[model samples]
Target: MKVALVGNQNSGKTTLFNCLTGMNAKIGNWPGVTIERKTGTIKGTNYEIVDLPGIYSLSPYSTEEEIAREYIFKEKPDVIINIVDATAIERSLYLTTQLLELDTKVIVALNMADILEKKGIKIDEKNLEEELGTKVCKISALRETGINKLISEIKKGDKLKRKPIYDVEIEYLISTIQGILHSSDSKIRHSRFLSVKLIEEDERFDKYQTQEIKHMTGLLAKKYDTDFEEIIATQRYNFIEKVREKTVIYKPVKDDLSDKLDKIFLNKWIAFPIFVVIMFLVYYLSVGIIGSNTVDMVSNIMDSFSEWVGNTLQSIGTSEVINSLVVDGIIAGVGAVLGFVPQLIILFLCIALLETTGYMSRIALLLDRVFRKIGLSGKSLIPFIVGSGCSVPGIMGTRIIENLDEREMTTMLTPFIPCSAKLPIIALFSGYFFKENSGLVSASLYFFAIAIIIISAYILSKLVFKNTSNTYISELPEYKLPNIKYIAKEVWDKVIAFIKRAGSVILICSIVIWFLLSFSFNFEYGVDIQDSMLASIGKSISWVFYPILGENNWGATVSAIQGLVAKEQVVSSMAVISGFSEEVGEGSQIFGNNTIFSSFTAASAYAFMIFNLFSAPCFGAIGAMKRELGSNKKLLKVVCFQTFLAWCLATVTYQIGSRIENGTLHLADILVIIAILLIIYLIVKNSINKKKDKCINCPYSDSCK
Candidate 1:
């Protein structure tokens, strides 16, 4: 038996799928589209469950949505599990009404129904089941309550179809359309579904348009004197309102915390500042105070473990080359990546807390006000939040933004936000250079990346992509208490993924780096560091580093380029190079004036961090971008744009910063001034040219809906 799970964004469809299949589908308050379906077997059964993307309706606006609607038509799964957010059942049922028209049986899983009682609300499941003509199960996927009953309902499948809810004329029109589809193809699965799509004039079925159906739609349009789509929508809402009257009961309650908090957190003037302060605190706690101490403790243990392995190899009379490979190559490189696990835990924990509290959703609504002005959709923020963990899925999340221009632009800018893989680099540089101010430096760079992204987006919207429009309406989930289990699971899963990365990519890269630095160009073993083949390679490309770091620091150049493989490899590469360098000392002295890290100043280090943060993301993310953008041409354009921006920003940051510290101005300063002026001029020109374009701030944007 096969089951398909579907729901609106944040309606807990993914959560219910996990509960039934014993799989871990990511859960967040943010509205993210799953570009691919995830499949898992239901526990103790042979039944396969496919979790489709979170979508608002069957009307396709993206590839994911089109694929999801296609799956129902072609795959024709035996059962459809539509998970509905019980707290907001009215809005949740909009998709439910559409799902009822499909061929398969649909079981409405009222997820989060447990919270409804706490909020002084009651639901009549019997009434709801009777009204929709399907089985209804109230289950809390989060708490695992009423799950067995839901599973049982899925087993005893319903034979009933969607009851007639529309007026007599509409129902007559629907039946006539269904006949037309059946007459064309007797093997068609979703005749009823296609019939409704035809009446709604859904563009997905434009190919199915026949003269007879067109004549009928023309008559209806003349009679109604309004949009055929809106007519169907009005009927659905009319039915939904009737169902709500029968099944729902709301009781009086005291003031909610969400309202109280939103007054301050959602305030027009102060909300943004509060968010900024909160982000800084989150970074400070994760990177500065708590993270620094925990990292030191773990670093000590790792140092000991490395020493022990080296001593054991030597005591066992292993070759010096083998000893160095085991100690300096594998352990040093991989261990450097692992040392930051403590910091990752703290950071993931902070994010998980925000997500659990439902504050993350509010950020989307808050950002919409600001995002629209900068030629971005509020939907762009969804990818930004997801990208904090990794840029690949963050890039994938751009599928939710329906606007082509906005989606492409968001994809181009998403990598500017630092991902978890980049944390080791951040922790490494900030801790080494700023010391006690590591967190401040780390957080500052984060907000700085965001600032640069905004500026770049403004430039792109004004000068490049024109006549772009964004249509966005995302639900604001009610604020709730933190779920401890969920948050812990979220943090632990991410931390484990981080460790797996260290063991795989970082470990392999460490061996390769060790080999290159160990052997000369002729493959001679145990060569001097400066005479190795790696040095030659680094020297060839190291000239590009001169503008950023104000010197041709080959080691820094090599490490920065290694980040393209995996951001964590940057630290691993550094550890490998420094371990091989004879001048580098132990502990904090590794970055001292006489060591391998001596070429770096505080300004250069910060610039280096910025460059890597905004540069072409890792190859994994580049592939994701390629897939999302749909061609090599678009991917190459984005990659070049990213790299060019990184170069310019790094150069400006280094040149201006160094000048401030050294009290000198040179030719670089003039170039930086010219670049800034060019950007300002572009925005000015765009503003003047587009002065008569449609204003997005019109209050009646939602009037039709």
Candidate 2:
């Protein structure tokens, strides 16, 4: 049996799906988290459940809404499990009304019944079932309550005799459109649905009908004294209000705990500071002493294993090249990334806890005021937070933003947040350059990324998206204690994914890099790495980073380039080239001994890290950008912008920082100063131009008068 799960955003639909299918799908407390559909099977049954994206309605206004509507129309699943939040049934049932219009059986799973009870609200399920013409089962998906009854209801397959709920005039218009569609060659199976859509003037079905339907819709709009779509929406809400009045009973109560907590956590004066402190704590615990100690332990174990393999290979008379390939190429490279798994696990766990407990949504609300100043909506916060885990999904999360320019700007700036893939790079550099306060260094990078994003947003708004309005609305879920089991599973999933990539993409790239560095252009074996093809290739573009690193070090240049493939590869590539098979601890002198690290000072290392952190993301994220941007020209523009920003920032950091540290200035320092002044000039000029444009459009303009 195929079951399709549908609900409004934050309706606990996904939580119910997880309970039914026993799938560890990532659930967030915000909308647009599940932009794509996911499928899983019931553990003890032959039933397959497909979890569609959370959508408000079948109006097909957004991409996710369109996806949900198309799947229901085309796939026609056996049963539609409509998960509705008991606390917000009126708003949720609006979608439920649309679902019932389709030719399918729907079992309404009233989720969060416990929350309803806690709030002294009682739902008359029998009355709801009778009004909606569907079986309504009360279930608390979070606590795993009443799930068996819900399952039984799904299995019973009781078909609903869906009654039309439109007004007399709307109903007459719908029937007329249905007759016209019936006479045409349209392949629409749900004639009633098609008819209502025609009256509503839904663009998706415009190609099916002709100018007659549009003309009829125009007449309906004139008769209703509002939009045809608005008329239909009003009818649905009127019906839903009646349903709520008949079935729902609410009792007065004192202030709830969520409200009490919100007084402190959501307070305007303290919320932002609390959010920053919370984030700082998360980073500190994940990358500071605790995480470092765990990583060191894991690194020791991996080092022992690597040594065992190497010694065993040597004892068996393995050839020099094969031994080096296994020990240096695979083990050193892959192990360098794997060693940081503990830190990644901790980071993901913290984020998962925040998401599960619903604090993330509040963070979005708190940051909305700040975002507006930079011409972005609060919705952009979701993508930025998600980007901390991975930039691909983060970029895809931009779909929730209705504004095209805001979405594009959000996409361009998301990669500035250091993702999980970039953790190893941050860890390695912090450990080496700022060993005493690695956590502080890492956390500062995140804050620096935020600063860059804000500044970039302001500049982009002034130059590209002048006078863009900032409008955002988001639902805030009740705060609940995070599920430990869910947090553990989420953390494990991320750790496993990191390991898989290390074994696949990073491993393959490591071998290729090792091979390239080991062989000359003529393909001769056992060539000196400095004289090899990889070195020659790296040197060709090494000069681009000379200002940042204070030297034309091909190793740093190559590592940065390899990051485009996978961010973790930067550290892995460094380990492979330096031949550091064992744990590469802080100030290990591995790179210092090798020529690659010989010229790098403390400032240069930081510059290198900043450059990689703010630069263009990995290929996977780039692919996501391509899809989201929808054009190669835009993608190219973003890529160039990212690279330019990274270069300028890194150059300024190295040149100015080196001058400050050594009390000496050079020609590069003067050039960096000039570059900074030029950027400021451009920003001021763009702001002036934007003000001029705004004045030109103003009603008070002298020309308009």
Which candidate number has the best TM-score?
1
Model 2 residue pairs with clashes: none
- Candidate 1: stretches off by over 4 Å: 157-161, 665-705
lDDT of 2 by residue, 1-705 (tens): 889999998888788878888887778666777888888987689898988888888876567777887788888898999999898888899989988877678989999988887888999999999999998999999989999988887789576667678988778877888888778855657788777887777777777667887787677677668777777888899999998999999998787888999999999789888988988887887788765677557767877898899999999999989998998899988998998887888889888888778888888888898898898888898899888999998999998887878888999999999999998888888776777688888888899999999999998997787655678665788888887887788788778889999999999999998898888999998877778778899999999999999988888889899999999999999888877322343435335544466567778878888999999999999999999999999999999999999999999899777887798978886888799999998888988878888889898877753
* Model 2 ranges with Cα > 4 A deviation: 40-48, 155-166, 172-188, 207-224, 294-303, 465-469, 522-529, 580-589, 592-595, 665-705
TM-score, each model?
Answer: 0.93, 0.89
Task: Give the per-residue lDDT digits (tens) of candidate 1, residues 1-705.
Answer: 889988877778777778888887777765654567888999988999998887778887777787777787778799999989888888889999999888788999988977787787899998999999999988898888988887787789477667986778778888998888888888887777788888787777899878898889788778787887888889899999999999999997687677889998889899899889988998898789876787668778888999999999999999989998889899989998898888888888887877768777778788886777788888788788778778888899989887888888999999989898998889888998898999999999889988987888887987676545856655777787877777889899889888988889889999999999999999999898888878889989999989999988888889999989999998889888888887655565346546567778888998899899999999999999998899999899999999989998999899888887787877787888999989999888887666524344555545732
Q: What lDDT does the true structure give each of the candidates?
A: 0.84, 0.85
Model 1 alpha-carbon miss at residue 35, Å: 3.8
Residue 455 in model 2: lDDT:
91
